[model samples]
Target: MRIGITYTILRREELEIKERAGDFGEVFMLHEDDMVFPSNLDLDVVIIRNVGHFKALYLARLFESEGIPVVNPFTVMLEAGDKLLATLRLKDRVPVPDWRAGVSEKASEKAVEELGYPVVLKPVFGSWGRLLAKVNDRDALEAVLEHRKWLRNPLYGIHYVQKFVEKPGRDIRSYVIGGEFVTAIYRYSEHWITNTARGGKAEPCYDEEVRELSLRAWEAFGEGALAIDIFEGSEGLLVNEVNPNMEFKNAARVTGVDIAKKLVEYALEVAKA
Candidate 1:
């Protein structure tokens, strides 16, 4: 069997995945700088890593056109890579926080007003909790919007506003592999945004609601390997986001799950199928 991983630079998780996958078969590290589009490559299955969305989509679609399976699939990547798309897809199917999408400053203001104060203004396409603003009032919303208007990337102009949920100083990050819930962790921080990338600490959590909701969210996205971010809301557990190419080094350390090994084993299963 042959497995291909798309990456520009190898992070800790990527290196771990590479090492574990090597135990199965020949592993090809398809670096972005060395790849050429519209060319046929021999590989049984391709695992899309932390590459950018457009490039990852291009590679996945190219390999898929030639009958090679892609982890998380191109469809999942298409939706999960964009916060707006993922929210729309997960709405109604799962318990997701209320959100609105728009393109103009006026529309963003209107959305903020509708969603009420303390709303989260997020870039449509972002991760690691970067470029997220917790707008407490009109003044803050105006300031954030004005800054976005000057940015070169038009994607910055697009607004993804969500109602902020008041949690108990932490949130749950659940790992789903091959349609199964492997483990979960509580990311705690004094700040409102509790992303581990933002210096939030991780602790092991074994919650039934997290598993059920995470599984439902994974199935909503046509399940593969995903990290589901869930918020404990006043009503119930709400899914905040679903990441296709998730970062799991912190989660692995806290949860004691050999995530890379399980991920590689699943990728090999895809290759075998």
Candidate 2:
């Protein structure tokens, strides 16, 4: 079976992912501009790197309409991609960090009251530490909004706000596949954002609670390959977000889980049906 894998041209690791894809089947790397596929040649599945990119998202839609399987279906990624929606989905399953929608100036104020002061405002759709700021008071919050408007950032209008958990820059990342635990890690940084993209370092963590939360999130997503981000605070462990298209290189390194083989095996099984 032939399969397609994608990563943004901006991300330097796209080639590395292609090398791994070779082991499963015929692998082709695509740039957004060069991404057209022939309908005549049937492909079994497409493994997307970042569904946030238009090229990859469009390809997912194409594969879905043609009845070709998408790893972590376009539907699941589309739903979970929205950070606000992802948080809400975990409400009953796990205790989530306090969050709110800053749809307008007044809405931001209301969310602040509901969630309390020293809250964090982030773009509803964002990754890494892009366009994020902590708003401790009304003035600071309004200033951030104005600054974004002055810079012509379109998302300045309305966004999401969450209560800032006090921690010394540490968090947990756990991987799950078909509702089974793969592995986990402790990501640490001196800054507010703990993304490996933001220079966070990975350390080993094999806590049982980490395993439990990871499985709960996987079950919440109806069992797909996923990464669940969690935070340890004074209130104990709380879920952060789930990204089906999450990066795996570091998680694999720290946890010693061979995620590539596992993902390919599951994708082929689902595609065969």
Candidate 3:
């Protein structure tokens, strides 16, 4: 099958996914890296790798409108793109991070009054530790929200305000595809966030319990696979975020899964239907 995979940034995960699909035949790595396709080439499947950027969003639309079978669809991408929306949909099902979305000024004050200080402030749509902040006091939270409101950035407004879970500052990235967890990796960081893009180290986690939570997260999405992140601690697991078109390389080696093979099989299965 002819498959076209888009890469917004040449992260190691994107590169490896391209290489893994090589065994499946005609795995085109679509990039501005001078990638060229035949003018009339017919791609059976187009995989949109979410780079958590507007460009990927635009290009994904282009392919979807062209009637190409886009994995995870544009709607799925957009749904998973917004943390606030995902959080609302996933609450109580997966121990979703104690989050409140689209809060009014009065509501924010009330929630903060009840939930206490030191909640997390995140842009509704963000990835890899970019533009995520923690607010420790009402003054700081209100100031940040005011600035973001004036700037019309939905990062603070129309976003998620989550209760902070003290984890010694580490999180887990559970890579899922095809209704199973390909692997689990602990992203350790002294800093608050453990995004690989932000200098976090990835470590292997083979705990079957973690793997089960990971699959449950994907299943919770209803259809299509997703990468489920978790903030784990003595209290147990709290769902961090869900990425429909997830990046997976640190996870592949850590869990010892041949990610390429597994992903190709998933694509073929999806295409068959």
Which candidate number has the best TM-score? Answer: 1
161: Cα error in model 3, Å: 0.6
lDDT of 3 by residue, 56-129 (tens): 66666777666666667666666766787677667756787676655566666676666777888777786887
Model 2 steric clash pairs:
none
TM-scores, all candidates, are 0.95, 0.89, 0.87
- For 158-217, candidate 2 gives per-residue lDDT tens digits of 678889988757899888876678888899999888988788999878899889988887
Worst 10 residues of 3 by lDDT: 32-41
Clashing pairs in 1: none
What does candidate 1's lDDT look like per residue over 22-104, in tens digits? 99989999888877866578888888884576777677787788898988688888898889989988897898988888888
Best by lDDT: 1
Point out where model 2 deviates above 4 Å: 10-17, 50-52, 150-156
Backbone clash pairs in model 3 (N, Cα, C under 3 Å; residues 3+ apart or in different chains), count: 0
Position 228, candidate 1: lDDT:
92
TM-score of 3: 0.87
lDDT of each: 0.88, 0.75, 0.73
What TM-score does model 1 achieve against the real structure? 0.95
Ten-residue region with minimum lDDT total, candidate 2 = 8-17
